[model samples]
Target: MGGSGAGGTNTGKRPNGQLGSWFLRSGWSKGELARQVNRRARQMGAHHISTDTSRVRRWLDGEQPREPIPRILSELFSERLGAVVAVEELGLRSAHQSPSVSGVDLPWAGPQTVALISEFSRSDLMLARRGFLGTSLALAAGPALVEPMQRWLVPTSAGGQEQPEDEPVATPSRASRLSGPELDLLESTTAMFRLWDAQCGGGLRRKAVVGQLHEVTDLLQEPQPEATSRRLFRCAAELAELAGWMSYDVGLQPNAQKYFVLALHAAKEAGDKPLGSYILSSMSRQMIHLGRPDDALELIHLAQYGSRDCATPRTQAMLYAMEARAYANMGQPSKTKRAVRMAEDTFSDAGVDGEVEPDWIRFFSEAELNGENAHSYRDLAYVAGRSPAYASLAEPVMRRAVDLFAEDTDHQRSYALNLIGLATVHLLKREPEQSTALAEKALKVAESVRSERVNTRLRKTLDTAARDFGDVAGVVDLTERLTAQLPESAEAV
Candidate 1:
């Protein structure tokens, strides 16, 4: 693969200037160059690249390499040469980068263009494993929102039809009004995800659900009528929102934010303000989880303001309660209490109608208030250094969230944190055994959820208990497990 024989093809010109400059300046042997390349490749996390003398000679003599190998070679040489080396300089520009979900040609693309989707997906997977919340936020809903809304407002097709793949095979239940192919597809997908969420956890199922939602989005894009099409689109949006929420739960904040925005677009087209509100609320919750309490507060306000007329009293109550949590986190106790009162007022108003809440919103009952307060107080406790009242509220509130969202890894993790909070209280009160037992119980639930935050907090509590209560074996063991999972930079390790 060398450029030519010793006497041929501009041999006296000493290869391309870029190649010649490197060789002459370094006065390196072919074999020595090969070794350098191999070392560089290893440092770059690359495996194969023959890196033999012959290959190095060919590369120096202006021979192009193949595909990814060429890119790696260029990168290696650039590092060694102390300059940027283009693929063309190595005569390997033709071997293009592989096409991902992004940087692709597609007719119908949403706000998460291919580039955004691919980056978001990889980011999600990485964040899930590392148990770190990604700090990316959603793009503003400007042109992205307007274009989709305008398109949906215009008539594209005469009638809506369901995909044959989505057809219902089983008889519909009396209580389950969901029928036909689209509804069947929706129910099945929801059930499948629900089960995965229980068994493997949301972190495991998030990608699959996101992919499915994208497929559903494509299917719903076909031209259809106003009413039926809108309903189908709304359902797809709901699924997308769920996928986003679960993704957020698993620490894929950037992707979750984009998906939520996409869900908002779909919901807007469907004229489903309530669903849009729910999506907004989900986004707000994610913001809070990421420790951006101010951003979360803004989102909650948006949700409450946008769905004032469309949302049911139950939904309103849920929104108010969420805002209360945000307010509490900000340490604005009066504002938090006001928000809680509003939620209570909404709930009381809804009680008169006795209207059933949506299945998705079923977890938002007054009985779940304890869990909400627990979460708020937990955040407050973290910010305030230490607060007895916050600790007191967190324990019972977390206990209730545990009971309600039990089997839910996310909630169970929250419950575990609450237990730790309670344990901290016990420790402050000089109760060693109670603290150790509570810490153990919290860790047990924590074992179920794939949460770095939960593990980190657990370690903090365990370490404190272990130091203060050195005789406690259980606390020591829990501390060890927590330490094992954390990076050395994290506390307790």
Candidate 2:
């Protein structure tokens, strides 16, 4: 909880000129400084620090405050300065201190955002472990979700600032104009990563996908024709979104949020409003899974507002379906059903005359919609007074999803998830035998994928089966077998 630096300790003999200088430059009175520090401390969940002008005077007189106060001061100055104001800069070094994450605070501008994401990718790649990125998922629900939504909604500068010109523009080369082949490679690679993630889960190849992101960053630095540049930005946005999805799947919610924010910036640069809306929708989904249905609802509203005119029918259907999910989580069956109907109607309209849909939304087919509906029904069954009718409704839809996924082997992870959903429905229906059989099949399929989401779902299903029918031999045997297959951490869950 101490600061970091190589500064000599003043024995409270003379005034600390550095502290006084920063304090003056910050344009805050001593009392105001103390009050701001106390407020920020409380927000960070630190022990309350009673402060006053007298305490500030003592600091100015070369009397260093106790542990944690220096760190708090560093943070406050950093925020005010719009730059990293280290404890060392504040001349408040201490011997015993806890470590802190190397924070990145980028402005919500165009090229700066690109630099921020590039630096983030490099830092993330170099770190041997997740470090601060491994923090709890609950931490992702607050500003991480709100900031991106707000930034996306706000207009930047007039004339719509162009993306950064390729570096070293004085020299003309192939790097000055991105060729068709480079764009195609990027698009195909993104598609391949998406497919692999759907089939095998993100845990297996997440780092490799991130490595591709590093390559994309290099491409972003190169110049291109106006059309090619737009396409490149769009491609970068899609790849970043995929990285976010993989990060979420592997239980790295905070890292996932970073990737999503980057995707939003790239989408905006590309002038792809619908793609930006889709990224917001994805963020909403993550919020919903984190049990913040209200936040998720707000994000969906933003997505709808931003893309009301531009989003195609297919994308609109997907957004409405997400809205249904948020409402279902909030236990508003009436609103949920309304949203679902809207989604269904829009989807039907999109199908007329074999109308082509955006490639990004091609995965939201009837089967995907059915699966989404089944999940909504399942959530309603649990939260809406445990309505048996909803449970009954979920079963057949989930069955259809399972059957659909079974036919498409490339979505084995999703197929396993559907099986888990169906098994839960059976358990709700009090059919222990069917539940046990379905749970076993799900576990077997899930074993092939390295998804924390699938593992978590399987654990939940097993927990449900054990609670309802622990004494039944079939249920007990199935649970034990599944437990044996899972990692120790997941098995414990």
**Best-performing candidate as measured by lDDT:** 2
- CA lDDT for candidate 1: 0.57
- Clashing residue pairs in candidate 1 (N, C-alpha, C atoms within 3 angstroms): 102-114, 102-115, 370-397
1-493: candidate 1 lDDT, tens digit per residue = 3222111222332445566565666677878876765554443334444467776665566654444455454544543443434445654443333333212122223322323433444555454344433322322222332233333223221223222422322222333232367666775676567555544445556657766665555545444444445556576666667777665555344446566766665665566678778887886676565555666787777777777877888888889888987887678877877887787788777657777655556545554565666566666665566666766656666666556655554345456656776677676556778788877777677666655456646676777787888777766766776667544221100
Tell me the spans in candidate 2 whose CA falls farther than 4 Å from its real position.
1-106, 128-138, 142-144, 158-177, 351-355, 489-493
lDDT of 2 at 399: 89
- Which stretches of candidate 1 lie above 4 Å from their native place? 1-179, 191-195, 198-200, 348-352, 400-432, 450-457, 460-474, 483-493
List TM-scores for all candidates, in order: 0.60, 0.74
Q: State the lDDT of candidate 2 residue by residue for 247-343, as single tens digits.
A: 8786565567678878888887677889999999888888777777888898898899989988888889999999999999999999998988898
